[model samples]
Target chain A: MQLTNRSKQVSNKEMTMAEKMYLPSIVQGLAITIKHFFMKKPTIQYPEVKRYLGPVFRGHHVLKRDEQGRERCTACGLCAVACPAEAISMVAAERKKGEENLYREEKYAAVYEINMLRCIFCGLCEEACPKQAVYLRHDRMVPVFLERDDIVYGKDKLVERLDDRYVRMNSEVKATPTEPSLTKAAT
Target chain B: MDLTVLLVKGLIILVIFGITLLIATYSTYAERKVAAFLQDRLGPNRAGPFGLLQPIADAGKMFFKEDFIPAQASKWLFILGPCLAMLTALMSSAVIPFGDSIRLAWDGTNYDIPMQAIEINIGVLYIFGVVSLGVYGIMVGGWASNNKFSLLGAIRAASQNISYEIALGLSLIAILMMTGSLSLRAIVNEQATFFEWNVFTQPLGFIIFLTCAFAECNRTPFDLPECETELVGGYHTEYSSMKLGFYLFAEYINMFVSSAFISSLYFGGYHYPFMNAVHDGLTGSLGEIAGHNIATAIGTVVFFAKIFFFIFFFMWVRWTIPRFRYDQLMNLGWKSLIPLSILNVVVTGAGLLYDIKYTTWLIVVVMVVLALTSNARAPKSQAAPQRA
Candidate 1:
């Protein structure tokens, strides 16, 4: 990179009679200020008037679910691996005989946690999730907490309720080829 | 004084005092609002709708604050400082006439009540004395604080007032020459018509007087005494709580009274164009007594409107100009204003002696020449630099 000289010489000439009087310039300055006085004040009164966030806004994380009210995460650990801050952690578990309705496939995440303090909202986990089990919510925000442990979100907080709007939107994930063939898996 | 007259006078004084206090309170709110508006923002809207009750809230806060004095401070003088400031500030308003006489029909006996609190013969002189006494408030407070910055601020204020007071007096001399009386009432009567305002006759003097008034009030660009950048809080650096509030509050009161003085002295007081016509018309339609009251009411409103304009002008100028450098302030006051004022007096005196109408024309001619010559001499090559 090339650096360029940015400084310029300042003139030190004495003020003329007009400049000395100062009334004319003062009058002009006043006129400008009065013009601004009538201009629209660009203030957003917070809380009552929430500003629009763009569609691509990355906020809090949400664990997705399939149409059958089953967890979509196969515990492949790709999202955990992709998280730059090492914020994501989860334990894998094999689905038992009676848990067929709960688990979409043989493998499911038993305990998923994300430390919100460590998370930078970079959406890398969402990008890395091949099965599309986790995505950053556009509308929701990570609430501040006083205690460090409180900020580390567990599966109870991370997992979206089946009735949530995002979960209904994610119900389409059942059609994806990544989901196991249901009849074969059931048998 | 007769018992009834004394009672009436006392009541009028009370009413005027209340009005002055109320106006001074609201002036603080107005100053903030105006400053905010100039910067394209809303100011203090949480206290009440449009922040109408802001002064009341501010006073409450001041009252509730813990009044503290510095460990090594002169407690008595420190306490006395702001009291003197406020007392002197309120005192000057007594001589200013808010309106013409109003006839009151009390128990079938009509008595004419004048709007001024005290109709002293030397009204202008009394005001000047009271205003000069304002410096004591600053000096005492700053001296009592035992702080170097406070001392510096006190000194700046003292010198600034002394310098500007000369120019102030000189400029008023020109007005006094024309009015031929020191009584504020007589001065107002002289300018009984709109165009006959001393501003038209003594434009140069008016400019000088206005400039001096800014210095006297310690407002920017003459506010070197309290320029926060240089002297912390200036004279009030050691002051806290309601003691500090008094110094700050007195400033707005001073602004109010000076605005009143400016309106009364130069801007035709309560005189409006076609006032006599309106009064006559009302008198013809209504009875003489009712018409006179209405006319006086209109005059009072007009007078207040003038005062408000000047107050707004003060705020406007504040938001526009930067504070003067100490040297520049001294130069402006002593070198420029004083000389110009002296010249104004000489010219006005000569013009008055020759003919009354000649004085006005001469002033106009002089103003035009000065403006044109100054404009012609401005450097041709200096273009305003473009922003990066």
Candidate 2:
């Protein structure tokens, strides 16, 4: 039974003296390697030149902020429940009387941590978020962690900075078209 | 010997030593670069521009590495092994004629100093002896390690070197018979013209010597002694730190020396095509002394160029050919190369008796006819029997 036409029959014939000499074959091999010696090398100088990951690629996690720079997460535990790796944890706290500018909702996350070592970067937390707060940034990747303490990222690392906003590529095309209200709320 | 001559010779020796070491050091880098290039990848370019400082970095690393000697190992012999290897490797270069004499005027006396460390009458024999002794380094190192693999490796090395050295010496004898001299400088002097190069006369001998040299140096395709897959770093398995570095450095030095030897012996060392014409022309234009010195300088450069090409060829072959199975290597060395070299010697002797030009042409014709006839007669593989 032939699997493909590329398969060749194994020959057990005695080698000719010419073949046994190995000089001709060695010259042929040398010719081949010399050709490759001048050929263009395909090595990418990695640290200096990073390859562009596609737009939909899930990478480092980011907690969103509102237009007014208020925290968008409402201390909701839906993202934690949705995470397949169970990598997310949070502490909820009530919004203070004069903290409306700081908190977008009555309740706020006092502490939010994501174990990057455990998280699979599946973007499920982004999907399960009701407040449009959790997102996996397409442009940035989670840097390699050196210590045990560095792997579990808290609000300091995860929260979106006011000056540096996380923007999605073609949000209208990627997001569900049926959910107009969610899109409007996100904008 | 005058004190000034001694001083000059000492300086020349120092220069040769420095060059040998420098070439050996950079060979490691060149080996990596060539390997990477052959595989279509960039080699080391991190340390400095094109990783020029890589060998220096490697030396530093070797120096910093822990000097380890196993409790069960023979300590003194283990230490002596690398030193012996390096010593023999360095010693072989002393007899190689780098170029013709350079005229140096010193203390109101003109001295024509030959560009060789020691112009001994028995340069070829000395080289052969040193090369043979090189295997002892591997053997001692492997044996002293007290490991089964190292012992096997050492045994392989000893047997391999002994077997190949016969063919190596025999192949050389064809050229020695033609030149009728054992001195390397004499052999080089005989092949002053391009066509007169020993390679043209003794092509078979050159091929055999090259194969033997590969086997002698333990380069890939003939590196059975240090078959890393089987021997786990071979003779240097139990070695660490600068000791292991010494073993590796010695191999490179051996490679460099063999390249130089090949250049001097077969390719006509310090001799280029129309060299006499060039020397005469230069002599007519410039003064005699200046022309002669410039010509000698050019010849030296040409000799070095030949050595460099051969070194590259060595690396090229290393990357191209796969390691030979032990039996195959033995078969080639003993059955094929040895017999071929013996035939080459007989042919050379016959050529000398008759017209060498006619004899060489006759041999070429015979080889071509034999190849054609063999190819025509070679049986094709029979088709597999069809199932009933």
Tell me the lDDT of model 1 at B100: 86
Best by lDDT: 2
* lDDT to native, each model: 0.86, 0.89
Write one digit per residue (lDDT tens) for candidate 1, span A79-110. Answer: 89989999999999999999988878799999
DockQ of 2: 0.52
lDDT of 1 by residue, B196-313 (tens): 8988888878999999999999999999888899999899999888888899989988999999999999998988999899999987888778988899899999999999999999
Q: Tens-digit lDDT track for model 2 on B1-388? A: 4887788789889999999999999999999999999999999999999899999999999999999999999999999999999899998899999998777666666678888999998999999999999999999999999999999999999999999999999999988888899999999999998988988877778889999999999998899888989999888899999999999999999999999999999999999999999989987898667787888899999999999999999999999999999999899999988988888788888988875732444554676677767777898667654434
Q: What lDDT does candidate 2 reach at residue B354?
A: 72
Q: Top TM-score: which candidate number?
A: 2
Candidate 1 ranges with C-alpha deviation above 4 Å: A1-10, A67-134, A140-164, A167-187, B1-4, B106-109, B357-364, B374-379, B382-388
Reference-based TM-score, model 2 = 0.92
Model 2, runs deviating above 4 Å: A1-8, A84-86, A145-149, A170-187, B106-109, B284-286, B355-361, B381-388
Candidate 2, A1-187: lDDT as tens digits: 6555565567877877667768878999999999999999899998888888766778889998988889999978999999999999999999999999998999999999999989999888888888888888777899988898898999999999988887774544463322223342453
